[model samples]
Target: MPPTVGERAPDFESLLCTGETFRSTRLDEALDGGCVLVFSAFSFSAIAENWWKRYERAGWADFDVPVLGVTRDGPYAQNAFLRYLESPFRLFSDVDGRVGEAYDLLVEREGMANTTTSWRAVFVLDADRTVTYAWVADDWISPVPREEVEEAVAQL
Candidate 1:
């Protein structure tokens, strides 16, 4: 299950990509002195791509804190989406789904054999690694609303 409000957010290490830069990043370090929105999505979904594309086009959601995206896709796919969408946030590759498993956000889809992908989810956490807001998808779409995320960070 995702960490509930007021619970300590799970710490994870993964490959993060920002613009053309890639690095091994830790969740706790991203949360230092600010907050991070752990955004999970399927790499190939039109809805996911379009929505994130809009966010990128608008150049919004650039709050004081950082919003990091996570997915089971590797750096190549992650960076491809980043390049295509021009997103303001960096994306971290949870290639083995370790981060997804930590948050219980993995979804096994049919026809994928034994492979699984991350369901859409959002977690806003503070510098101390405490979750301030959490939203897990009920279906293939409907990730957390952007307004809610902005409001969450505005209060921070």
Candidate 2:
């Protein structure tokens, strides 16, 4: 199961894609006032593209907290995806799925033997790394609850 509200979020270290380059980032070190952590399957999928576009249109960058994305894709693919979207937020490369596993977001799709991907999920964390809010998609393509996330950030 995933971390619940009021619980300390699992800390992780991964390669962060900054559009131009990659850098090692630790979850605890990245926290400022608060942050929204997004976990998704593939960076290049249509669903993922639409997800990022939706956030862009919703003015997600204007929120009080920083938003970060994570996927199992390599840093190279993540860099390209971030560049292509012209996204304001950075993406972390969880290539080994260790981050996903730590967050309990890893899922094995039906009919895809030995293949595991991070489930679509979002976590709002305070500077102390405590989870303020958590949401996991019921299915692969469910849309993120942007308004709720915005409200959560506003409370930070």
Candidate 3:
């Protein structure tokens, strides 16, 4: 199961894509005022593209807290995805799915044998890395509860 509200988020280190370059990042070190972590199966897919576009339209970039995306794609693909979206935030490359496993978001893809990916989910973390809000999609394509997430971050 995924972390719930008030639970401490699992700390993780992964390759971070800054749209222009790649670097190592740890969850604990990235915390500031707080942050939003978005998990998806992969980058460059139709569903993933649309999901990020929705976030962009929702003004997620202007939130008081930083918003970061995590996916199993490598840094190269992540960089291209960020550039494609013209995103203001960075993305973590969970290439080995270790971060996904740590967060309990790893799952085998339906109808695809031997393939695994992170489920679509959103988490709002406070400065201390405690989960203030958490949402995991029941299915692959469900949209994130943006208003609820925004409220959670605002309260933090």
lDDT scores in order: 0.76, 0.90, 0.91
Clashing pairs in 1: none
Write candidate 1's Cα lDDT for 1-156 as tens digits.
Answer: 778899988888999987577889898877745575555556656977876776555444566777788888888888877777766778889899899888877888878888887777777788887888888878876545777777777777
Among residues 3 or more apart in sequence or in different chains, the pairs in candidate 3 whose N, CA or C atoms overlap within 3 Å are none
Model 3: how far is 74 from its true place, Å? 0.1
Candidate 2 wrong stretches, greater than 4 Å: none
In model 1, how large is the Cα lDDT of residue 80?
A: 77
Q: Which candidate, 1 or 2, has the higher TM-score? A: 2
Mark the regions of model 3 whose C-alpha exceeds 4 Å error after superposition. Answer: none
lDDT of 2 by residue, 1-156 (tens): 999899999998999888899999998777778899999999989999999989989998777777899998999999999999988888999999999999888889789898899889999999998999999998998889998998888888
RMSD of each: 1.9, 1.0, 0.9
Model 2 / residue 1 / CA error / Å: 1.0
The C-alpha stretches of model 1 lying farther than 4 A from their native spots are 57-59
* Location of the lowest summed lDDT over 10 successive residues in candidate 2: 59-68
* TM-score ranking of the models: 3, 2, 1
The Cα RMSD of model 2 versus the native structure comes to 1.0
